[model samples]
Each structure stands twice: as C-alpha cells, then as structure tokens.
Target chain A: MESSQNQFSEWLNKQIHSSNSGAFALSPELRATSLSVLDAGVFPNRKNEEWRYTPLREILSQSPVLADKTQINPALIAAFKEAVPNALHLVFVDGEFSNEFSGSISALDKTGLTIEHISTLHGESRKRAEDTIRQSSLSDDNIFQHISLGLSRSGLFIEIQKNHEVDRIVHILHLSTKSESRNFSNPVHVVRVSENSHMQLLEQYASIDAGKALSVPAVYIEVADGAGLDHFKIGLESNQSDHVSNTVVQVASSGVYKSHQYLLGSRLTRANLEVIFSGAGAQASLRGIYLGNADQHLDIRTFMDHAFPHCSSDQHFRGIMNDQSRGVFNGMVLVRRDAQKTDALQSNKNLLLSREARVDTKPQLEIYADDVKCAHGATVGELDKDALFYLQSRGIEKAEAKLMLTRAFAAEITQEIEIETLRSYVQDRISNLLDGVHASNV
Target chain B: MLSIKNLQVSVEDKPILRGLNLEVNPGEIHAIMGPNGSGKSTLAHVLAGREGYRIDGGSAYYKGINLLELAPEIRAREGMFLAFQYPIEIPGVNNTSFLKKALNEIRKHRGEEELDAIDFLDLIKKQMKLVEMKEDLLKRPVNQGFSGGEKKRNEILQMAVLNPLLAILDETDSGLDIDALRIVAGGVNKLRTKDNAFVVITHYQRLLDYIVPDFVHVLSNGQIIKSGNKDLALELEERGYDWLLDKAETRD
Candidate 1:
C-alpha cells in the first residue's frame, strides 16, 4: 500500500513538472495547495476504516495523465443541446469551460442571480469563491477533495439572490473526450442559495468513448435561512472510466435541501456526501440508486451531522449488483448534545441478482441527545420468493415476473425524483440494465 | 370437469391429506366442510400446484390432463383459478394493472385477442360492481393495506374478470361478516355457467345458505367421511362433527 502511494505521488510530480506553460499559467494558489497535500502523503489505504471496503490499488496502478483543454466536438454539443433543451447548460470539456458549447445566461443576469466562471470572477465574487473553497476544504480529510480543489482550473459558480425564485434548472455537463492514454480530470462547482430563495440544479458526468479515464469532482453548497434547493447528480461514464466525487452541503435556519443521485455506469465509482444543519428548523433528504454489473465496483458513503435543535434528516439508498460486481453503502447520522428534537432516519437495501454478486451495507446512528428520535436499518438479499410466486401465479412467466419485481424494488427510490423528464430517463436506463442482466442470465 | 382418485399429500414429510378422493362435473358447486387442520386447504393448494407439497400417491385429472404435472402458472393459464385463503399482499403493483395482465395472459392462451386499455377499464368497472369493490381500490397496490373483506372481495373481483372454467374458493368466507358473505356469494353466483364448475371449501355451513351447493361433503382426518345433499349441512350444524366421527368409527 505504501509503495502504491509512492507510485501515485511520483506520477503526480511528473505531470506537474512536464506541464506546458499554458497549464502553469493558472492560479498558483490551487497548484501549491495540491502539491502540499500530495507531499503530506494523506492518500487512503486499506488500513483506513472508511476506505476498508474500497481498494484504490487498481485505480493507482496505471498512472493517469492530467487531461488538458480540448476542443468540444460539434456533434457532441448538438447531442447535449437535444438531450436537455429546457435547461440552462454549462458545458465542460476535459475539466475546462467550453464557451462555444455553453448556453447564454445573460437574460438571467438582471434577475438578481449570478452565474459565472469561477476563474473569471472579480472583487467580491472571487473572495466568496475562495472562502467557499477554503471552508469546504477545511472539513474534508480525503485526498480526492484536495486533488480536485488544487487541480481544477475553472468551474461554475452559481448564486441565487435573496427572495428570488429561479424557475429554470441549471445543468452542469462534464464531458470527457477520447484519449490514447488514461486521462484524469478534476472539476469543482460552488452553489449558494440566499435567504428565502429557491433553486434547482442538475450535474451530469459522461464520456464519449470507451477509453480509460478518471474524473474527480468536488461540490460545495450552502442554503441560507428559509431557502430551499433541489440538487441532483447523475453519473453515466463509459465502461472503462473511474469516477470519484465529494459533495459538502450546509443548511441554515428553517432551510431545506434535497439531493438525488443516480449512479449507473463506470468500472469503479465512489460518491461521498456530507451534510450539516447549522440552525434550528432545518431539514434535508438524501436519496440515491446504484446499479453494477460484471467487475464493476460501486460505493456510496454519507455523513449527516445535526448540530442544532429542531432539525430533521432522512436518507434512503438502494443498489442492484449482477454478475461478479460488488457494492458498498455506509451512512452515519450524528446528533450533538445541543441538538434536541432532532429526528433522523436511514435505510439501505440491496439486491444481488447473481450468485457471485456481493454487497456490504452499514447504517449507523450516533445520538448524544436524549430527546432525539433516530432509526436505521440495512438489508441485503435476493428477490422475495413469495412475491415472485405471486406474480407467476397470475399467469406471468418466471422471467417476466422477476423483471417486474426488480423494477418495483427500484421504483421505491426512483419515484422520489421530482423532475418528470429526469425520472423517466433514469427509469429507461434502469430498464435497459435489467434487460442486460436477464440476457446474461439466459 | 375434475376427478381425483385416492389422493395422498404430505407437507414436510407429515401427512396432511391421506387418500382423499372427489369428483365434480361441469355446472356443479360442491362444498367441503371440515374442522381445523382437516386438509381442506391442502387439497386446494395441491390442485393449484403450489410447491413444497409431496404427492405420495394418487392422481388428479382436469379435462383428462394430469393436473399434478403442470406448474402453477400453467394451471392458471389453463382456466384453473384458486382464490387464496389469505391473499398475498404485493406492494407497488397496482391492482388494475395486475388484473389486466392476468386477464390478457389467459385470453392469449385461449386464442382470444387481448383487451385494450379502454376495454380493460370497462371490464374491470363492471366486475368491480359485481364484487361491490370501490373504484379507488383499483388504483392502489394489490391487496396492500386492504381490509379483510376488501381482500376477499378483490379475489372475487379477479374471478369475475378472468372467468376461469374451474374456480376453487379456499375459505373465501372465513374472515367475512354476513353482509360480505352475501356479496361474495352473489358474485360467485353471477359468474356461474353450465360450462364451468366450483369447489367451495369452508369450515362453517353458514356460507352454504347463500351459495346453495348441490352436494355437501364432511371431511375428517383428510378423508370424506360423509356425502349428502344441502340437508346434510343442516344436520351437521345441529349435531356437530363429533357425532359424525363416532358414527363413522362404529361403521368402520
């Protein structure tokens, strides 16, 4: 494990030393921060409790060269425009902003909302962006967050002003182009919702070709008093890609935050989410679904901290593993002593569709307050025999019966999606994956 | 329409149905009444081809085809319906959608065209009235959160829609009040035809007062100890099973 860390450090040093002048012309603060974190040797190994189930040896064995700015293909841009026509699109190619591919948001500038590239910010906006980065970086102890913060050149910065309601959904699209060698990308995004405001955001990660690639993205969000935000993150990378993302959210007094994540593709994927309630009457809901097949490995880790009284939170996640794939889910809810009247619930359910498929789930609730109501449950099993028999007895074939039961199990999570188009799109993807699982079994 | 000869069934190597025999032709309704653990439900499950039941001996034939050789779904497709004693609650499966799929599958097997959405809705509406089921129940999950009477009525509603040639009512009146029993029995009477038959299994003679079975059989220790007309049910109601058991023991 130590040798693996040394190998990754050597690779990072080589990439930084051999970079061209254009790459070095970016912010020196980010580069210096990334280097110091690398030199500290804080990369996680099997010994770490949080990373025990997920080994990064396979990801680090082959050095991934840092992907530079690349031209966005016209066809890819056209396809994205068609995929989400109603959304305000902000496109990123190889972790850098692509101006020609992004949609114009000038009409939104006069409505007390600001959406700009973080590197192009001046004065107060730049200071706010730096403060957000510093605050989010101070709380995370993982190497992935440090890498994303230090290496990301330019990313999106969105702020919804106080008392304003944003009707249009802001979509951030991260598209990876084809490369001969393994390519690595780091992208960061910051979102701030002011008092009494409402906003919706969708973040999508995708790749064009089946080349080896790695993506590390960091997100920082803050919901002010009496504000509400609905956020969704979708991961649909190519089969040979590896993705790791970290999201940190803070909710203030009487605020509401809801997040939905759909992880459907990639050879190896990890999504770490942390949320904190800083004031009374705040609430949050986190829901996700992940599907894995063949040699894929999918992991989701969440931490919910209730530091104020009269706060509530709920977390529900489901996973489906087929063939020799594996999945892991770990959720922890912590209620401090001062956080009386705190109500939290967590549930993680998984289905193993094949004999070799495996899943590990842990749902933990640590309460230091005597007046809190907390509950957690975890279940890992195959389809219910009684349910399958009931369907078959109604004249449905065995294969079709199994498919219907699987779809119903997944619907419990997908039904929570509020956006109609996104919900249907996810259902169609899940239906296709189920069809593949049926075919492989046959 | 159905014939069983010396049927012997066991669950978990414990004998539950020992050499039970029965016969029923089309256009006949037969009632089998017995005490608890008398294997009345076991006989129904065996006919429906439920697993975990070992047939030590005997044979059952439906329209001259081996009933024991078919799977549960095959039996269902072949116009055999078993109204479960306790309907299984399936969450997330809409009631209407389940009924539509079931009816379409049976129709396809019988060389009939499938019903479209409009036709399915119309058929279910009419059948719902027959069983006195509410329209909102169709939009909810199949039997999930349903009351006891509602589950039984839902079973009868399914029977009205599928219109199977042989319908076996397994204690459908067990957990129902008199009003519910009347409604359910009325639903069965409406669906009865000369080409179809029924075998109603019950523990009380109360259900017979409404459905009016042509023949009544008293089952004891997995065997039919007595067979008579509707009057026999009244006799048992007056004298109870102990008297019948003593008479049978002396005769043996």
Candidate 2:
C-alpha cells in the first residue's frame, strides 16, 4: 500500500511538472500547500475511521492519465438540452469549459451576476478568487483537494452582487468522454453570494459512455450576511466510474443555506460535506438521497459546525441499497462553548432491499455549550413487511407492491425539492433505474 | 358463496384457531360475535391469505375455488376483501393513487376495462360521499395521521369502490363513534347486493343493530357453538360469552 501511494505521488508530481506552463500554473502559496499535503502522505485507507467503509486501494493502485481537452459529442449535448431546456447550462468536457455547448447568459450578466471560468480571471479578479479559495480551505489533509488544486486549473467562479436575486438557475455539467484505460479529471468551483442576495446553483457529474474514469471535484461556497443560497449536487456517472467530491459551505449571520444531493449511479462514490455557521442566527438545512445496487459502494460524511450562538442546523439523509451494494453515512455536529441556544438535529435512515445488502451509519453530537438542543438518530432495516402486505392485500402484485413502497420511501426526500421540473426529472430517472432493476430480475 | 370446514391455524407454532367452521350463502350477512382472543381476527386473516400462519388442517372454498391455494394478491383479485382491525399506515403512498391501482388490478382480473383518471375521479367522488369522507383525505398518504374513525371510514370507502363479492369486516366498528358507525354500516349496506356476501366479525352486537345481520353465530374456542337469527346476537350481547362457554363445557 505504501508503494502504491508513492507511485501515485510520483505520477502526480510528474504530471504537474510536464504539463503546459501557463494553463495549469498554480500560485506559490497553493503550490506549497499542495506539496506539503502530498509529502504528508495522509491518503485515506481502511485504517482511517472516516474511510473505514470505503477503501481507496483499487483507485490508488491504478495510474490514471490526466484527461486531455476533447470536444464533447453533439449527441450528448442534445440529450442534456432535452433534459433541462430552460436552465442556463455550462458544459465542462474533460474538465475544461466548452463555449459552444453553454447557453447564453447575457440576461444574467446585465443584472450584476458574474459567471465566468476561473482560468480566465485576471488582475484583481484573480486575486479575489485566490483569496476566496484560501479562506474556504479549512483543511489541507484532504488528498483530493490537493490534487484538484495542483494539477487542474479548470473551474467556475460565480459571484452574485449585493441586493441582487438571480431567478434563473445556473447548471454546471461535468461530462467525461470515453478514453483509453482509466483517466482522471478534477474541476474546482467557487461561489460567493453577496449580502442580501439570493441564488440557486446545480452541479451535475456525468459521463458520455461506459468508460473507466475517476473524477475528483471540489466546491467552495460562501453565503454572506442576510444572503440565501439553494445548492444541489447530482451524481449520474456510469457504472464503471469512480468519484470523490468535497463541498464546503460558510454561512454568515442571518444567512440561509440549503443543499440537496442525489447520488444515483457509480461503481464507487464518496462525498464529504462540511457546513460551518460562522455567525449568529444563521441556518442550514442539508438533505441527501443515495441509491446503490449490484456491487456498488457509496459513502457520505457530513460535518456541521456551530461556532456562534443562536444558530440552527438540520440534516436528513436516506439510502436504499439492493443486491450486494453497501452504503455508509457518518454525521457529526459540534457546538462550541460560546454557542448557546444552538439547535442541531441529524437523522439517517437506510433500507436494504436484498439479504446481502449492508449499511453502516454513525451519528455523533459533540456539544460544549449549555442551553443547547442537539439530537441525532440512525436506523438500518429492510422494507416494512406490514406495509408490503397492505399493498399486496389491495390487489397489487408483489413486484409492483415493492416498487410502490420504494417510491414512497424516496418521495419523502424528493417532495422537499421546491423546483418542480427538477423534482420530476429526478423522479423520472429513479423510475427508469428501478424499471431496469425489475427487468433484470425477471 | 363461501364455506369453511374445520379450519385450523397456528401462528408461531401456537394455535389461534383450532377448528373454526362456517358457511355463508349469497345475499346474506353473517355476523360472527365472540369474546376477546376467541380467534375472530385469526379467521379473517386466514381467509385473506396472510402469511405467517400455519394452516394446520381443513379447507376454505370461495365460489367453488380453493381459497387457501391462492396468494394474498390473487385472493384479493378474486374478490376477497378484509377490512383490517388495525389499518396499516403507509406514509407516502397517496390514498387516491393506491385505490386507483387496486381498483384497476381487480378490474383487469375480472375482464373489465380499467377506469381512466376522469372516470375514476367521478366514481371515487360518489363512493367518498357514501362514507362521508373528506376530499382532502384522498390526496394525503394512505391512513397516515388519520384518526380512528377516519381510518374505519376509509376502509368502508375502499369496500364501496371495490364492490367485492365477499367482504370480511374485522372489528370495523370497534373504534368508531356513533355517527361514524352509522355511516360505516350505511356504506356496507349500500354495497350489499343479492350476488355478494359479507362476514362481519365483532366482539359487540351494537354493529348488528345497524347492518341487520341475517344470521348470528357465537364463536367460542375457535368453534361456532350456536347459530341462530339476529335475536341470537341480542341474547349474547345481554348475557355475554360466559354463559355460552358454560353451556359448551357442560355439553363436552
């Protein structure tokens, strides 16, 4: 395992040194930080309690080449256009932004909203981007973040001006095309919602074909005082793909931050979400749904930190595993000594559809302050036998009954989505996936 | 329309119904009254083909078909309806959609055309009136957060819509208030036809006064000890089950 880590480090170093100079150049500070992290060799293994359920041995052993700039297929573009026609889409192929496939954003630009690529920033704008990244980088122990910073320079930088509300949704589509052997791509994104502004953003990761690839993405968001942001991250990659993502959010006083994540496909996927309440009276709601089948392994870890007084945070995550799939959920809530009147709650529920399916859930609440309300719960069980019988006794066949119960379980989360089109889109995708499973069973 | 001979059932190796026997012809309502733990619910569940029960012996025939040989869903499609004593609450399954699906499945089995959305709405609206159910309850989840009376009324509403050939009401009037009981009984009476039968299982005879059963039977230790007209229900209600148990023990 040590040898494999060394090989990965050496290969990453070589890629950084041999790549084109200007496009992938990193600032001195970021370079130093990345190098120090690489030298620490803190790559997660089964020994790490945070990564005990999901092992990265297979991903680390493979020497994945850095994906080259490739034109996305027109057919794939057409498919996305049909999926979300009204939204403004920004397409990223092989980790680089595509101009031809993106929608026109002139209407949004006139209203003081800036949506541009990070690599295109110059002068003070570039410095501001770097500063945002520096402030949001809470930890340097994450190897994936280091990799994303050191080698990949393609990402989005979105900023909403004060007192402006962006009604249109901004969708960032990350598409990976087929390549020889397994390839790797990393894209970083930064979003800053100014004071008294509101915005909605969606980041979707997908692949064009059934190709072997590994994607590591990083997202940083800051909700300023009295601002609100609704964010969604969707994972719909191929079955042969492996993905790891990190999302960090900071909410100021009186600001509201809401996030919904849907992880529906991939061979092995891991998502780490961290939200920090840095100011009093800030609120955050985090919800996610993950579905796994066959031999897939899915993991979700969340950290909700309450550093100020009179803050509240709630998180609810649900998982459905079938076949030989495995799911893991770890949620931790921390309240500081000065953070009184803090309200935090976390719940994780999992349903195993098959005998071989397994789930591991852990909920931790660490409170150092008095007069705070904190509670958490975790449950793992099979589908309710009585509910199934009720449906069956109503004349529904066994298979159809199972499907209805599964849909009902998922509706608890999907119904929370405020956007109607997106909710229906997700519902359609889930229905298709379950239909495929039924067909295979038959 | 239904006949059972010496039906014996055990749950978890413990016998609940030792030797229950009954016969019901079309166009008749048979009220089976018993004390608590006398196998009233066990008989209803076994007839509905619920699993987890070991059918020790005996047979049940519905319309000359072996009812025990069918799956729970098949039995339902074949016109067997069981109004649960404790209705299960499904959190996310909408009441209207659940009823629509069940109605369509039964229709498909009976060689009838399935109702479209508009027609289904029309039909359900009429049936909902029979049970005095609110229109909003149809939009909510099935039995979720419903009151005891509301759940019982929902069961009768389902029965009215399905119009089954054989309906088994297991303590349908247990938790209902006087008004709810009257509405539920009225709904059941409206659905009763000359070609269908109903088996009302209850511990009290108050429900029989509204539905007016054609026959009443006393179930003691999983066997019918006496069978007579509706006055028999009045006698049992007046004297309770102790007198009947004493008479059966004396005879044995």
Candidate 3:
C-alpha cells in the first residue's frame, strides 16, 4: 500500500510538471506553491486519521492520460441540461469548457454578473480569480487539492456585482467521456458574491453512461458582507468514474451561505468541504444526502471554523448504503475563543440496508468559548422495523414497503432543496438507484 | 365470517391467550370488552398476523382458510384491516399515497383494476369526509406529529379507504374524546354492510353507545367469561367486572 501510494504521488507530480493545461491558468506564485506541495506529497495512508475509512487503492492503481479533443453526443449534453432547465448552462467536456453547448457568456452583461472561463480572463477578472484562490485556506489541505491546482485544464470564475440580484441559476456541468486511456480532469472554479448581491449556482458532475474517468476538482467561494449564495451540487458520475473534490468557502458579516449536495454516483468519491467565518454574524446552512449501492464508496468530510463572534452554522447529512457499499461522514465544528456566542449544530444519520453494508459517522465539536452553544450527533442504524411493518400492514408488499421507508429517510434531507426541479431530479435519481437494489437486501 | 376455536397463544413462553374462542357471522359487530391485562391486544394482533406470538393450540379460520398461515400483508390484501390502538408514526410516507397504495394492492388482489391517480384522489376525498379528517392531513406524513385523536381518526380514515371485509378495532376509542369517538363510530357504521363483519375490542362500553354491537362478550383472563346481547355491555359498565369474575370463578 505504501509503495503504491508513493508511486501514485510520484506519477501525479510528474504529470503536473509535464502537462501544459491552461484551464485554470494560475499565477506563477500559486502554481509554484502547488508544485512544491506536490513535490513533498506522500499520499495519505490508512494511518492518516482523515483517510482511515477511505482507501485510495482503486485510484492509485491507475494511470490516466490528460483528456483532450474528446467527441461527445450532443443529445447527451442536452439531456443533462434538463436537470436545471432555467439556468445559465456552462458545459465542460473532459475538463475543457465547451462554447457550443454552453449558454452565451456575452448575454449576461445586463445582469451585473460576470461568468468567464479561466483561460480567457484578461486583467482584473484574472487577478480576482487568482486572489480568491490565494485567499482560500483549506484546513484539510492534501495532495489532491494541489493536484487540481497544478494540473487543472479548465474552470470558471463567477463574480456577482455588488447590490445585483441574479434571478437565474448558473449551472456548471462537468461531463466526463470514455477515452482510449483512462481520462483525467481537474477543473478549479471560483465564485464571488459581492456585498448586498444574491445568486444561485448548481455545480453538477456527470459522465456518459459507463464512461471511465478520474475527476479532481477544486472550488473557492467568497460571500461578501450582506450577500447571499445558494449553492447546489449533484454528482451523477458513472460507476467506473472516480471523483475527489476540495471546496473552500469564506462568509463575511451578515452574509448567508446555503449548500445542498446530493452524491448518488461514482465508484469512489471523497468530497471535502470547509467553510470559515471570516466575519461576524454570518450564518451557513448545509444539507446533503449520499446513496451508495454495489461496491461504491462515498465519503463526505466537513469542517466549520467559527473564527468570529455571533456566527452560527447548521449542517445535516444522511447516507443510505446498500449491498456491499460503504459510506463515511466526518464533520467537525470548531469555535475559537474569540467566537463568543457562536451557535453550531451538526448531525449525520446513516442507514445500512444490507448485511455487508457499512457506515462510519463521526461528528465532533471543539468549543473554546464558554459562552457558545454547540450540539453534535451521529447515528447509524438499520431501517425501523416498526415503520416497515406499519407500511406492510397497510397492504403494501414488503419490497415496496422497504423502498418507501428508505425513500422517506432520504426525503427528510432532500426536501430542504429550494429548487423544485432540481429536487425532483435528485429524488428521481435516488429512486432509480434504490429500484435497482432488491428488497431482500434490506 | 371469522372463527377462532380453542386458540392458545403465548409470548416468550408466557401464556397470554389461553383457549380463547369466538365466532363472528356476516353483518354482525361483536364488542369484546376486557381488562387491560386480559390479552385483548394479543388476540387482535394474532388475528391480524403480527409476528412474535406463538400459537400453542389454535385454529383461526377466515373464510374457510387458516388465517395464521398468511403474512400480515397477505391477510390485509385478502380483506382484513386492523385499526391500531397506538398507530405507528411513519415519517416521510405521505398519508394519501400510503392509503392509495394499500387500496390499490387490495384491489389488484381482488382481480379488480387498479385505481388511477384521479380516481384514487376522488375516492379518498369522499372517504376523508366520513372521518371528518382535515384535507391538509392527507398531504402530511402518516401519523407524524398527529395528536392522539387525529391519529385515531387517521386509522379510521385508512379503514374507510381500504374497505376491508373483517375489520378489527383494537381499542380505537381509548384515546378519543366523546365527539371523536362518535365520529369514528359513525364512520364505521357507514362502512358496515351485510357482507362484512367487525370485532370491536374495547376496554369501555362508551364506544358501543355510538355503534351498538349485535353482541357483547366479557373477556377475562384471556377467555370469554360471559356472552349476551347489547344490554350486557350496559350491565358491565354499571356493575363492573368483579362480580362477573366472581361468577365465572364459581362456575369454573
């Protein structure tokens, strides 16, 4: 395991130095920092507390070529856009932004919103993107994030002007396709919501049916004072795909950040999300659901930093594991001494449907302030027998009954999604996944 | 049309229903009045095919078939319903959809065409009026956050929608106020027909006041001690069960 981990790290480092991908076109200093970090990167092992439940054997055993000039079916892209029909679509095929499939970027001039591809950004927009990326400090900084930073080929930089409210949702779609060699893509997206402005964004990662790819993406978000951002993500990659993402967000005073994530695909996924309270009185509400079947593995780790006073954060996540699948949730809420009167709540509940299915949930709270209020809870259990019998007693078959209870368990979290269509899409995807899972598995 | 003869049941090797015998014909409503620990709920659960009860010595025949051999859902699809005393709360399962699915399953079992969405909504809307259930309750999760009376009413509403042949009311009136009891009994009365039967198990005779039973049986210590007409319920309500127990003891 150690030798393979080291080989994976060395391979990725060589790729970073050799590849000339201008997608995320980072500044010379930041690029150098990423390479240096990658230089010293010994890939995380099982002994690493954060990577204890997750194994990188599948990812480390592969050698993927940087994807370029891949052919995609237009109908497939059109169908994927239906997930968010009314949004401004930015489509990416194998990490490169597709101008033909995406909505016209020049048409958003009247909306006080600037959406530009990283490779095309010139003066100020380029500097703003670099500055945002430089300002983000990831508490769980690892080799993967630097791999995305040093090797990204394409991504977007979105900035909402101060006091402007964008009604339309901005949809960022990353579509992976099958290639001769295993394809690899890392896209770094940066979003900035200015003061008094509001916007909604949907970042979706999917693949052509059964297409094999490796995706490493990084996202940096900034919510200025008095601003609001509703961010949603749905990962529906293929069963042969592997995805790892690092997202860092900073919220200013009086700002609000609401994030909803539905992870329902991928052979293996590790999603790390960190939020820092850069100013006081900021509030963040996060909700997510991950459903895994077969041999798939899904892991979610969240870090909430209460650096200032009077900031509150609430997080709720649920997982449904079936067959031999596995799920992991590790969330930490830290309240600093200066963060007096901070309120934080964290909860992670999981359901294992098969005898071999498993889950590991850890919810931690570290409060240094005496005047703070914090609560954290974690629960892992099977479906309630009483609920199942109740449904069965009403004449529903046992299979249908189990499906109902499982769907309801997920609905508790998915119902919090503000977008109706996206919610339905996510719910349908979940139902489809569960439908393939036989009732006897429960 | 249900028959239980010498039905002996036990829970975890501790006997609960010892030689309990009862018979019900079509169009008749039999009220079985018993004390708290007299195995009334056990009888209801066993008949409804709930798990965990060992049938030590019994023969429960429903429509000439051994009832205990079928699963709970099979029994339900075969026109049996149990209005639970303490209805289970199923969060996230919508009330309307649950009822619709149950009704459709039963309909399919009966070789009838399944009701479409519009038809189901129409049927449920009319049946909701029988229990005086609020329309909004149909959209909420099943029995979740419902008050005691509301939960009882929801059970009755489910009964009305499913329209079972052999319905068992397991202390349905226990948690209801007088008005709610009346509404629930009224719904039961409206659903009764010459082709169906009911076994109303209760701890009090008050519910019999609204839906007068054709027969009243006093159950003590897992067996029926006395059987008579409706006047027997009034007698038990007035004189209590001590005298009846003493009589049964002396007779034994």
| lDDT of candidates 1 onward, in order | 0.85, 0.85, 0.89
- Candidate 2 lDDT (Cα, 0 to 1): 0.85
Q: How displaced is residue B38 in candidate 2, in Å? A: 0.6
Q: How well is candidate 3 docked (DockQ)?
A: 0.80
Better of 1 and 2 by TM-score: 2
Q: Write the per-residue lDDT of candidate 1 for residues A241-314, one digit (tens) a residue.
A: 89888999989999999999889888889899999887999999999988998988999999998989999999
DockQ of 1: 0.63
**Candidate 1, after superposition: displacement of residue B3 in Å?**
1.9
Clashing pairs in 3: A23-A153, A23-A154
lDDT of 3 by residue, A1-442 (tens): 4574455666786776664545346766678888888787757778999889988888887777767677777988888888789999999888788888998885138889888877677788888888889889898778888988876767888999999999899999988888765578888999999999999999999988666778899999999999999999899998888999999999999999999888999999999999999999999998999899999999999999999999999999999999999999999999999999999999999999888999989899998999998999999998888777777788988888989999999998888887898888898999999998855453
Candidates, DockQ:
0.63, 0.84, 0.80
The runs of at least 3 residues in candidate 3 whose Cα sits more than 4 Å from the true structure, single-residue gaps closed, are A19-24, A106-108, A439-442, B247-252
* TM-score, predicted candidate 2 vs. hidden true structure: 0.97
Categorize the docking of model 2: high
lDDT of 1 by residue, B15-93 (tens): 9888888999999999999889989999998998888899999999998999999977888899899898989888667
Greater DockQ among 1 and 2 belongs to 2
Clashing pairs in 2: none
